[model samples]
Target: MEAINISYRAMIILYALITVPVLICFFLKLGNVKQILIAVLRMTVQLAAMGLYLDFLFRFNNVWVNFGWVILMIAIANITVNRNSGLRTARMFLTVMLGLTISAFFVIVIFIFIAIRPEPFYDARYLIPISGMVIGNCMRANTIALERFYASIKKNEREFLTYLLMGATLREAALPYIRESVKSALAPHLATLATLGLVSLPGMMTGQILGGSTPIVAIKYQIGIMIAIFTAITVTTVLNLLLSLKVAFNEYSILKRDIFRN
Candidate 1:
């Protein structure tokens, strides 16, 4: 069965719903209506372009092409993570790129080959979406982990130095920061995992159901995807931090002031 398509007129009506918030912002002097409208327009344009590319991906469905796309995605996510983490991209680029690529590729290979096992094994429909979900979550986790971690160390230079001066190795001294970063980065995901079915209807399951998949099937797929997402985020966050340690610190174990960009 085919999912019902939203008409252009229906989309216009849906877009009209934003007018309420825009007007509210306008009256309250929130000064973001222009930004809001621009963001909405950008979202429309971006999604339209993505839809076009996705159509091509589905049509071609070549194994190498699919993997090349995933690699491109990994590169983009790496760049985005570093850019938003307030870290100088040049300093941490290779570490972030390699860390995320390894984690994402490892998880996706296991997930698709051992778990999902779609036809042809490299089906774009399966590989692309799953890779996106994994890479996207990993990106967010890395951003939070890196930003919180470096900011914490930078703010606690005295304590970090004290740890170092008191006979702690660089690894030992960074342990506390690493623990804090990993915990904080994964916290929201832990909460979401706990509250998932009872409090939330996940998008994957909802979309599957809307696409005429059985509720049971949708739930099963959602469970697999959630596990993959959780694993990918956790592994990528830790790997990024560990791999970045060498680049982020000096020979004296000092956190480099130049690593972070204001």
Candidate 2:
């Protein structure tokens, strides 16, 4: 069965629902009604624009065009990760971009080629959405990992230095912080995975079901996507931190304060 479309009137009603929260915020003097309205407006405009662009992309479906869009997504995600992680964009851009691109494409290749294998192998429909999901997760995970890792070292500089002075190698000194950062980055996803179906339905599975796929098919796709997301996040987070070592620190094994955006 084809999914039902939402008419403009229906969509307007849905948008009207935002006022519920806005009213609550105003009554409580929370002072974020304006922010909420702006956020809703931005989301509406961005999704509308994206819908149009995605329509064109699906029709064009050229391999070069598809890969180009994926690259653009990766670039945007890379910039966002750096900005949110409080890292100087220019300093970590290339390294983090490399990590994200590698991990995202690695998982996408396996997921699309081996698992789904859509006809034409590079079908924009399958490739683009999967890439977006994987890259998006990588962006968030990398942000947490990078932010926590650097912040930990900066906050515990004396302790970090003590590890170094007491015969620890650079990697050895950074190991504890790395472990903590990776764990912090992965924890939310792990919890989500554990509570997935019991707590709430995931977007992919719900979308697939609404789009007319069998429940079994939707569940399988959701499982595949979740695995892909987790793998991409883990690889990108660790690879980003490891590759960044060359630029994040000096030859003398000192963490560079200048790398931070502040």
Candidate 3:
């Protein structure tokens, strides 16, 4: 397969395009100019670093190094999940990490190793990008699940306590929150799936076709990636939210208010 490369000078010019939106925001007084600028700047820097690292990783072709890189991505994602969920690093880090790593690895291995049977199981080319995509999606789902669950419980403390006082077990009392949280996390994906072909072209499928894969082959890969994404999101959200229950509550089965950041 041929590689598609872009020049660094082109990237700089592309980054400058962000200023158009920043100027528009300034004139309209929408108050998002700084935030938008910072976000674009950070995205540029982060993707640039990842691009350089990926170039080295593809060149090395070392199994252990590739595995190490995947683990590092997972760890960073784990931390991001906790932070985004408003959960403290001290309490929920390992559970989120374990849940995301386990769910992502299971799905990726089943798809890439057993199904696609990519030549080297740990090939950086396939393993790194695929695992990154899976972990990245799971991170978003888990964050939403965790945050919404805790936030709902806190916002409805009286109702939650009523359930407990009405002879509901901790698990029973928390089920409503669990259902709502999972729905909130997965609803966007469901909507995307429903309007997929009509609304927007999916990035993965577009990339595959642009890389010279046949339309049929690209469509199949797109279907496979979507299935993996949906499955991983469901598994990670449920598992992480379930695991978080252990640390999110007190002896009386009430969510602790102090767990949230101000």
For lDDT, the strongest prediction is: 2
lDDT of 2 by residue, 1-262 (tens): 9799999999889988888999999999999989998999899899999999899999999999999999999999999999999999999999998999999999999999999999999899999999999999999999999999999999999999999999998989999999999999999999999999999679999999999999999999999999999999999999999998889988889999999999
Query: What TM-score should be assigned to candidate 1?
Result: 0.97
Worst 10 residues of 2 by lDDT: 11-20
For each candidate, give its TM-score against the true structure: 0.97, 0.98, 0.91
Of candidates 2 and 1, the better by TM-score: 2
By lDDT, rank the candidates, best first: 2, 1, 3
lDDT of 3 by residue, 124-220 (tens): 8888888888888988888889889998898999999999999998989999999999999999889877777789787788898878888898888
Candidate 2 local distance difference test against the native: 0.95
Model 2 TM-score is 0.98
Q: For model 2, what is the alpha-carbon lDDT of residue 71? A: 97
Report, for every candidate in turn, its global Cα lDDT versus the true structure.
0.93, 0.95, 0.86
Q: Give the Cα error of residue 185 in candidate 1, in Å.
A: 0.4
Q: Deviation in angstroms for 190 in model 3?
A: 0.6
